[model samples]
Target chain A: MTPALAIRNVSHSYGARKALDDVSFSVPPGSFTMLLGLNGAGKSTLFSLVTRLYAARHGEIEIFGHNIMREPGAALRRLGVVFQARTLDLELSVMQNLLYHAALHGVGPIEARRLGQAALARAGLAERAKDKARALSGGQMRRVEIARALLHEPRLLLLDEPTVGLDIKARADLLALVRELVQEKRLGVLWATHLIDEIADDDQVVILHQGRVLATDRAQAIVVAQGAANIGEAFTRVTGVAQEKLSA
Target chain B: MSEIAAPAGFTFRQYLICLSGVVWREGLRFLHQRERFISALVRPLVWLFIFAAGFRQVLGVSIIPPYETYVLYEVYIAPGLMAMIQLFNGMQSSLSMVYDREMGNMRMLLVSPFPRWFLLGSKLLAGVAVSILQVYAFLLIAYFWEIEPPTKWGYLTVLPALALSGLMLGALGMLLSSLIKQLENFAGVMNFVIFPMFFASSALYPLWRVKESSPWLYYVCEVNPFTHAVELIRFAFYEKVAWTSLAIVFAYTSAFLVAAILAYDPARGMLMRRGG
Candidate 1:
């Protein structure tokens, strides 16, 4: 089967400053792919390119087999994204936010309502549907966003630092939710983060450092190949960052 | 991956659904913010009640084509105030856009599977719809104050003109919003674009009066799109049409819309290093 996403020889620059250089990676179906990067490591830049928020001017990005620039409608239909920023309109009810997103994806009112209610219930937010979005906690808001992302039944989900501000318990629950999605729904996930604990030994890893991909393989494979104890050390060895700083 | 990729598009039914959804959301936002509705009406009503009252003695009116005979100063400035509501509304949409960009709501809309032009056009139409409601509300209030149009049909005739003029100003606002990335910088836009566009147009005074004051300002007013918008509304209110003004408003609306579409394009427009 074709990889759910492909970035071929992608390089992006901001005027004289380069943000991403020769970066390429792919996430296979039914796998948790960790995009490991430090702050300003061009992770978000790659996400922007993949989502067509910014055109991949120097290379090509394809979802499944659809080119984003040539067939954005088709590519976007199969892809769902949760950006790093908070997006819910605080003034709108939780259901309104979900319905608004559903409408943008061309979902009809009756069907959107059905899917929205079900999605919110799955997120443990069924009771908050009529409440203002501001009533939800940070973790609840993140869950709402995830529920919104899945409303279209996308084949691939791209999340950028989703657990950044969440508490440890909430973070674990969030990760488990996504992991369950991968296992049960056979969804392709590109989870971008700087956290080392989020990656499992069997999970696919893409180590991006300073705009370059240092390695692309299983977490255990990279750790064993580098003779490191864990993903943090492996990342340090490949990217030349200190082990102490890697986990921090 | 589906093998068939010819740049997919929504069916007409899907397109209509999306359109209604967008308009409905806009209406919801408008309804939730009763202050926005009040402010939209208050701005025009203030001028009609106070500024026009004061100017009634300063400016004498001759029989213009749109005016059957001698008309009150408040009657003469009614269309301008209606267009003012739209102009402010267009800017209001821009303000919302700036805020929405920061809040990430714009990202949700921009990531839609539909075309960008269609999305922006729907937003423009929504803003126009809001402006029309506000205009009619102001007209009802003004009607009680003896600011009625020439004919009862004038009320209906003015609807299309208000829509067209709203589109022109709304497109202008959309173009500005695309260019304005930061909210702090928006204050400068209000001062530089809004005040000048409103005051330099024939909204407050006649072109002959402007020419008498300064010939260059008269020329500026003649070319101002807002002037044409006001003229369009003025003529339509009297059951007549200003063909030249209509064409000019249409052309400017198209130009502004095209520019807005380009400005919002990430690859072609605003490719600032921080964002790209």
Candidate 2:
């Protein structure tokens, strides 16, 4: 079977600086893939390309077997994205934001309401639907973004640091919800984050460093192959940077 | 149950819907900030009522082609006030763009499935609608001041002209917003654009009057797109069509729109810096 998301030799650059250099990868249908990288590792750049925010300078990206560059509209319709920045409209209610997004995608009112409610329920934000998005707590606002992303029931989901500013429980809750989404909805997920704890043992992991993919494998296998006690150590070995150095 | 195949491609309807959605969002934001609407009307209102009153005695009314016989000083400056509303509205729309960037809503707009041009165009259209509203309000207030146009049909002609001029100025604002890196610099730039573009054009005074001051400045005013815009509105208010002014406004609108799109292209590095 063709992978739900396929990226082939994608490269991008900012003036005088290479943000993503000849990167290639694929995620099988219904699989959860974790993109691990440090700051400036080009993970966000890759996400931007996949979401069609920035067109790649070289190589092709396919969404559900559709070429992203040549057939962007079709490819984009098959995927959903949750950006690192807070995209919710602060002045509007949660339901209003979802309805606005639905309208943008051409979803009718009835279907939008149904799908929006289901998504909010899944994200544990159903009761907060009528509340202004600005009035919600930071974690609640993040959940609203996740719910909004799922409103279209996309086959592929791209998340860029979804749990960046969440508390420990909020982060765990969000990750757990994402895992459930992958299983229940049969979604191919590309979860980009810099934290090793966010990657599970069975999850497919790709280690990116300096705009290049250093390694791609099962999280457990990578940890075992590096003779490391944890996924963090394996990440350090592959990326050639120690945890202390990175923190500093 | 049989499976339903997804469609092969997107349509212009999708683009239209996205554009409408963005415009609706801008309208809602404007509604939320009621003070902005009041301020938008009040600025032009003050100039029309107070400034025009003070200058009416000193400023001589000349026999311009668009005007029949001698026109009142307030009537003479009404189109300028309309143009002023559009200029300020255009800048106000971009202020929201910068605000959205800082508040993070602009990122949402950029990540949509639709092309960036449609998104930016929708924003310009919304600004046009707001500018039209302010123009009509000014017209009603001018009526109270006994400077009403000869016929109500004159409004129909003025609408399209205001739209074209609003679009041109709004496109310029979008281009500036993309080029300006910091919000602090916006005030300085606005002072530069707003005053020069307004005073240099035929907004407050006639081009012939400008000629008496400096012939070179009159040449610059003649070439300024704002002059054509003001001329378009001035002629329309008299129930006359100024084809030359329309052509110039349309030409400038097309150029500004194209430049705005190129400035916003994701590959052009402007958006990349913001996205990055």
Candidate 3:
């Protein structure tokens, strides 16, 4: 089977400043990949390219063997994105948000409603489906966004700093939930963040710094290779940042 | 991955469904925002009642319409005000686009499998739908104010003209939204684009009246795209179609829409300028 996502030698720039530099990675089905980078490390820029929010002029990105630029309709039908920023229309009900996303993916109303309800149920937000998105708490709203992204039944999910504003418990719960979905639904995940704690030993980690890929391997492997005791030390060593500085 | 099968490329039926969904959401959002509906009416009504009342005597009217005799200032400016509503509404929709871009809602639309133009078209159509409702409401109020159209058929005749003019202005707004870097600059857009377009057009004053005062200003008013839009609606309200105005409106819509599409191209750095 083809990898869920494949980025080959992609580079992007804003004017003279390069944001992503010949970056390359792939995520297999049912696996979780953490895109680790510091602020201004070009993780978001890579995500934007992968999602076709901006075109990558120098390289290519593919979703499930379909080139994004060549076969966007086929490639995008299987990809979902949860951006870092809040995307919900505050005035719209949770259900309305999900249903609208479903429609955009060519899902009919009846099927959209059915899948929306199921996604909400999965997110533990079925009870709040009728409430306006503004009425929900931030954590609840993030869950709704996840539900909406999954409404189209995308095989690959790309999340950019998903737990930015959530509390510790909420953040942990969200990570756990996403992990469970990766296993249960066999969904490929590209979770981008600067947080070191979110990286698990078994998970694959891609370290990007200043638009360049430092390393791509299992978290445990990186730790062992760097002669570090834990991923936190391994992350700092790979990205050339101090531990205290990283957490700060 | 095995849980959900990926569908094929977008089908025509799916396109229709997306269009309907977008339009429906716009309608629902409009209904929820009662202030938008009220303001949409109140703006034009104020112009029709108070502004026109003051200008009626100052602007002499000749026998030029389905009516054999001279008409009131209210009658001449009605279509102009209607087009003005569309122009403002088009810009308002652009404001929403800017807000949505900042808020991340635009990403949902952009990442869809459908073509970018289709998604933008759906949005334009939705804005037009709302503008149409607002225009009809204003017309109803005008009717109650004893400012009726030339014929019962005139009401229906104005629909296509309103839709075209709305789309023209809406496309222009979309282009501006794409080019504008920051949301705060939207107010600048109002001052530079919206006010100039509204005032310089023959919306409040007839082109001939401007000609009598300053031929240069008359030439500017005659060439103004909004002026043609207003003229299209004005003629339609009198149960006639100004073929030249109709063609000009269509041309302006096409040009603005094409420019908007180009400006919205992610490769051009507009969408990428703001945080996505």
lDDT of each: 0.89, 0.82, 0.87
Native-to-model Cα distance after best TM-score fit, residue A8 in candidate 1, in Å: 0.7
Kindly report which residue stretches of model 2 are placed more than 4 angstroms away from their true locations once superposed.
A244-248, B1-4, B11-16, B267-269, B273-276
User: What share of the reference contacts survives in each candidate?
Assistant: 0.68, 0.43, 0.76
**How many Å off is the CA of A235 in candidate 2?**
1.2
In candidate 2, residue B238 scores what lDDT? 84
Single out the weakest 10-residue window by summed lDDT for candidate 1 chain A.
Answer: A239-248
Each candidate's TM vs. the true structure?
A: 0.96, 0.94, 0.97
| CA deviation > 4 Å runs, candidate 1 | A243-248, B1-8, B271-276
Order of the predicted models by TM-score, top scorer first: 3, 1, 2
What DockQ does every candidate get? Answer: 0.64, 0.47, 0.68
RMSD of each predicted structure: 1.9, 2.3, 1.5
**lDDT of residue A156 for candidate 2:** 86
